[model samples]
Target: MNKRKISSLLAVTCITALIVSGCGGGSGKAEDKVVSEKDYEPYSKYESPVEFTIGRNTSHTNNLPKGDSIENNMATRYVESKVNVKAKVAWETDDMDQKLSLSMTTGELPDVMLVSRTIFNQLVDNDLIEDMTEVYEKTASEGVKNIYSSYGDLLLDQVKVDGKIMGLPMTNIGNQHQLLWIRKDWLDKVGGKLPQSVDDVWNLARTFVEKDASGTGKTIGFGMNQDAMNFSPIFAAYNAFPGQWIKKDGKVVYGSVQPEMKEALADLAEHYKEGLIDKQFAVRSDEEKEALVINGQAGMLFNPWWIGYTNYKDSIKQDPKAEWVAVSAPVDENGKFKTIRQDPVGGGIVVVRKGYPHPEAIMKSINLTTDFLYSLTDDAVQYKKEHASEGLTDHSRWNNEPTQIPMQVDYDDVLKRYYDDIMKADKAGSADGIQEDRVVSYEAYQEFKQKGTAVDANTYGEYLSRIEGQREANNPNLEVIPAGFYGTTETMKLKWANLQKMEQEMMLKIIMGQASIDAFDQFVSTWKKTGGDEITQEVEEMSSR
Candidate 1:
């Protein structure tokens, strides 16, 4: 035999010997024999544990078990025992941006880590991360593949670097558009019809402020965070979306500086002057705003679907009668609800270090988590029982856990299936159709029978998610305009933060009557002069590419 054939024969002989003896150092058993790398599967446990280090960012809001920490949590321990992969914490921090920057400067990156899109691009440009294209295709579970496919071609295409998969994006539900959250009880009390037009919205706000819809002596027509003046659904209603680059007249243009924005600003300024919006909202936090809804100080808000867990929950707790409902943002004369949809491409992505030997480990970890959390199987049932005390059943806490690109299923699809179960139960006139996955819906339905809206926080959140999905699923009037650009352009990197601060300051001043409406004209003039024009040109270049 030639030398090449002799080498191949010897390699085969070693593998066969290991299989027969079952004494190899590798994880594969005789039954799970892998003659080559292509035979590897994500769920295959290593006979001997493999260890790697990861960098983690944490927060108090994570609600990690009392004594458990980022380095030694239930999640880490579970993966170690089950997958035979031990992820030791190389570093942990709350301020990930600063720490990640420091790591990059020192050239001490972890084996695996999650990073923002900006940092991800930087890593790609420097060739610091591994090319996961082949391994991902070979090892990704059906569930993981399906989740990524659901993001649509645009999202998946956006993550590719030179047509090679460099990182795994943390996909978000694309249909998470803003909705107008109003106090249902207040609408009933004022005998108010659902606001159908921008003018109708203004009228309702004015009436709520003038007539005290909350029935409390102290009431505000609207509750909003500091950025709401510039970023809320109100701006979208007028097609004046800020912080978005939109294609106008076959060219990319900044939405904030558009003429439509001036009109939206005028309307918002009028509300500020009329005391329709809380005077202190310019300084308020989201938490404070939610508190206003809870304490009966505000009647209307523009928020996302998940408000049930916080704003609605607190409000319902304080006043059992305080019912809330979500409706689409008011429309224009053309009956178009001009809402600005987010760029389908998400921000967070998980990457493996260039030198790491085990890119497949990330895929394996993802598959295991997917099986534990999503699969409707006996394993998941057992997992639930095992970690019930640690709040494993509450998937919201899963975000805090260590894993690669946490969710392996589309969030909206998960909700849709739960909605299906709920609807099935309703039609059957029995709760048997309700599945374990529909925790919020199931819990809410049970409490709904005893106390109705008095203690229906979980149900309300799930209800809102389902209702919003149904509303947006086929609504032609809902204009789903994509942001022309998502990441920072070259000029933007130099001046965007300053420009945002100036815009926020100028808008707040105009709203508070400290500056004239004409200031907007000056602000736009300055904005274009100071890098905005260059940024637009850059965005045009990027879009063309």
Candidate 2:
């Protein structure tokens, strides 16, 4: 059949099936059977097994149990047993981006693919992905729906292409806030207080460099990666948020080309001139910069709170006294600690092939895994026990298909619940009223009682939660992205990357003392002439609509 005929046939079949066995009785006729809600519950197993193929990122860190492959792991087995869906791995590559691009170019995408926002948008544009509107509504459980709904209209709006939702967005909370990860031990050794302003940071970085806090005489006062010059937390101090659109005088403007950025660049240039920043930072990879922190060569780093997991874990293991703490980005002129907030839409999105037989399978799998991870049922308890030591790596990375609830989603709420309900009880040596989700926090609390700190990853994660919660609760000056900033404009696909490369080059050149600050003005002019103006105009149009 042709595409139109196939679409028409599918539409009729869907309508007929819905009328025969939907929530509402069809004309109250004897031919139609209205089922109870329990019959449609998300957790129930399929009557028979179904199968699909998918692509996956085969990271080396995914340590599966003995004799189990990614396709046949415990999590996959559990999913198959529960949902009756067997997910075969069609392809595996550590570089998901490159692999996905190759698949797209070859017109051979899997039944489902985990993809970043840009790829998802491109797939939708090419008409290679399914419109998941009906399947999601029909299959998503209350918990899964609630999680997405809590993100507000931004989640709904950004995923839509021409009024149709192209993919399911991952859910996370407050993961975008830039934090200053200061080494507390070094701070005490240098007798420097936490930075409260731009000037304070300048002074602290100078002192840290002068004091040779690394103990190897090669201390880097400010740690930075290649992307840092553009996305650095220091920009927050100057109220210049890069990689976003901001409204100024009732018009959309690109953040990187704003005047405030010039000031930030000037300040960074001064830091570089004084040797406070690593002179070779422009060439350092993320792993190398992370090592600078982990090996005690960098006194201060700027990134999100999750850096604790990526960079600090090994350092803490090697040196128990190397304490890292997350602090708010330094205060702006108004005595407010300002930081750029992320678009609430989480990482990668989940997309289905254009003519996939079982579009609802993706929704069902997400609903099942989310409930399995968060719900306190007997099965969920057993699931936790089976994978407690290895964590949820298999479920999240392999079986969940694409996205999982972000690592820091509802982090503060969970932490608050721990303190309010589980802390005192656990301190008194009782486990009553403690939920499964808070079990890890309970363990951390016990460790805190015994060792004056939570040492392991899970336990230390809880410790970081307390600090983040307290900081945000007490003082939050987060500059959130406007509703429409996250959406991609047509020109962005063609020119945004080039624009960002130009911005990074110019910004780095100024900061490295290779180009004068005057270069910023000429670059801004070139930016507008080359496509920034058109992109800004498109953003304004979208925001208005």
**What is the TM-score of each predicted model, taking all chains together?**
0.84, 0.79
The per-residue C-alpha lDDT of model 2 at residue 85 equals 68
Tens-digit lDDT track for model 2 on 1-545?
A: 00112234434544453344321111122233233444355666667665566777764534555566666655566567677767776777888788876665555567777788767766665566778886667677776767677666656676777677778876555544667777788899888898877888778888888888768889887866665642455786787877767777788777888999898889888888999888888888778877887777887877665554464656766566777677765777877765544566666777877656566666766666666656535675687577665444443422343222111123313323445556566656776566656555566666755775337654565555544433442344654445326667779889988999998889888988999999999999999999989988888887776
lDDT of every predicted structure (CA atoms): 0.67, 0.66
Best TM-score among the predictions, by candidate number? 1
Model 1 lDDT on a 0 to 1 scale: 0.67
- Residue 441, model 2: Cα distance from true site in angstroms: 4.3
Report how far off residue 146 is in candidate 2 (Å): 1.7
Model 2, residue 96: distance off in Å is 5.7
Candidate 2: count of backbone clashes, pairs at least 3 residues apart or interchain: 0
Instruction: Supply the TM-score for candidate 1.
Output: 0.84
lDDT of 1 by residue, 254-273 (tens): 88899887887888888888
